[model samples]
Target: MYQPRKRGYRKDNATLRWSLPDRVFFACGACHILAYAFLERWGTPGMQALWIRPAAGQTGNHVFVDGGDWVFDYHGYANRPQFLAHVWRGARRRWPGWDATLVPLPRDVLISEQKSRGYDGLWLREPGQFLHDAMPRANAYLDRFRAPAVRTAR
Candidate 1:
């Protein structure tokens, strides 16, 4: 007959020490590089450059761009593609007169982690030369989804 040994409570230092499995879990959870890769490969081309600002007097993470023409309640999205698709659809409907040749975010808009309310999507530091060079391609991409223009006789 064998007696079972009782386990003792762990000390504070013991709790602080992570096992190999624990370390691996933490590394995987904190891996922003994987997130960036997904964004680059599958995200809408110019959508990554848009800057989000918190809606005024909002209680939770409600954000907007293009002077409230595009609003996203970040809680609703499960992934990047869903969010970008929603934004693209909303912009098309709300601001049909907008300059489709350019990315939707304004040149003078300021983007900071604080303003973004800690949402971890790509954002532009400045309206860089890349955007200028990329505009024609981005516009071409958008044009594919746009409704054909209607002409009326004067």
Candidate 2:
């Protein structure tokens, strides 16, 4: 069983303890960054980044790529229904007071948030160091599903 871990724990305290594979697939709590990487790697024009939140001004927001029929997250690609059910159930189990809802995430807003949070430049520049195994994990997950055809010509 994988549980999400708090971000920014100190190294001397042994806070960054998960194995590479576990950090990539289950924990790390950096879904917004990973979601953007996944979008860059496999997103079609029809797909967009979205945040799942309980409501306005709430914590525990989750980010993932949303294709019309499918979604890609730390768990990899899955049909929309299964993804929603999984998120809803998991969220409810984790936080009994909130209900999850999908919210649109404009690219600009995402970039701004990333920048404000001190991740914008660092993540891309030193992805392996900042987010070990993310790209490789994304590639492996993507291998399980055929890439969506480009919905529109560039």
Candidate 3:
């Protein structure tokens, strides 16, 4: 299980040895790419990209793919209920007083948010490269679960 790093704790030990993409697994600034990658590859028409943000505090925004029955994030895959519980627990741990809400987002919204952050939008322009760089390390972790991740569109 990937443990969320404590806010402002910047000590690097074994994680330094991991590849840059691997290290970004559950780290900051990764949710967009990770979630986008999964949705692009495996998402069905019924699925939606969700943006989870706390109602208070400085908690960062999180994006994940929600397939009605299941959800996949940087942490891997889980049933909807299980994923919600996990996210709720993490939010409580990190921001004791805040309420976190999951909002369904469109692809354009995600791209706009990324644009606000000054991403050149390489992922949008070059999906092949984006998938090439991001999926391998993610799949390595996700493959541990009983449910296999989709590497390409069916």
Candidate 4:
């Protein structure tokens, strides 16, 4: 019911947008946030932040252990780099080895508006192929993050 106007729309940067009650699925910041939300520090050692995707819906805003549909809902992240930076930073300190890395999607990615049955509304991916696929908009955000850093040489 509360689909606020979209924010962070920039041709050069990525942004996230979702109409609520409609579910959101994302992984952009999961590897970082999940550790605390899922296991509350005891789970830090094995969690890797190399490549994260965040997805969520209204109910998606909690850690799986936090009980709101799998830990703060990665799906809701939608291209807010500063938010992403914060999440990753917290995760980095929690898991110092997680300095982000180049890990391609598990397979060729797919992005779509359709969601599998039982989902409340809107979706970034179906369960089966999620690790390998990304919704069109979500993938756009990923690409923007993965973009090579511009370097200036003296």
Candidate No. with top lDDT: 2
RMSD of each: 17.6, 5.8, 6.9, 15.0
Instruction: Quote the positional error of residue 145 for candidate 3 in Å.
Output: 8.3
Q: Candidate 2, which segments miss by more than 4 Å at Cα?
A: 5-27, 56-58, 108-146, 149-154
Expressed as tens digits, the lDDT of each residue in 1-154 for candidate 4 is 1123336532222233222112332333222222222233222332222223223221211222122111223343233355446656765565564543222221112122242112333233332333332344333434333222223558
Tell me the tens digit of each residue's lDDT in model 1 across 1-154: 0111224422222322222132221121111221222233333333333333223331111122221222122121234455555545555465553222213332222223233333443332211222122223323333333222234559
> In candidate 2, what are the lDDT values of residues 1-154, reduced to their tens digit?
1353546554233335333354444334456555666677776567898767555444455677888887877776789999788777776677686675676675444434344345222221223434354446545555666665555647
Candidate 4: regions farther than 4 A off? 1-75, 102-126, 129-154
User: How well is each residue in 1-154 modelled by candidate 3, as lDDT tens digits?
Assistant: 2344544433243243233445454444456555555655555677788867656444546778887777877656679898788778876776676566777766654544344344222222222233244445555555555543444657
Q: How does model 2 fare in lDDT?
A: 0.57
**Which residue window of length 10 is worst by lDDT in model 1?**
25-34
lDDT of 1 at 75: 23
Residue 49, model 3, lDDT: 81
lDDT score for residue 139 of model 3: 51
Model 1 stretches astray by more than 4 angstroms: 1-128, 147-154
Ranking by lDDT: 2, 3, 4, 1
Instruction: Please give the lDDT score at residue 13 for candidate 4.
Output: 29
Better of 2 and 4 by lDDT: 2
How far residue 78's Cα lies from its native spot in candidate 4, in Å, is 4.9
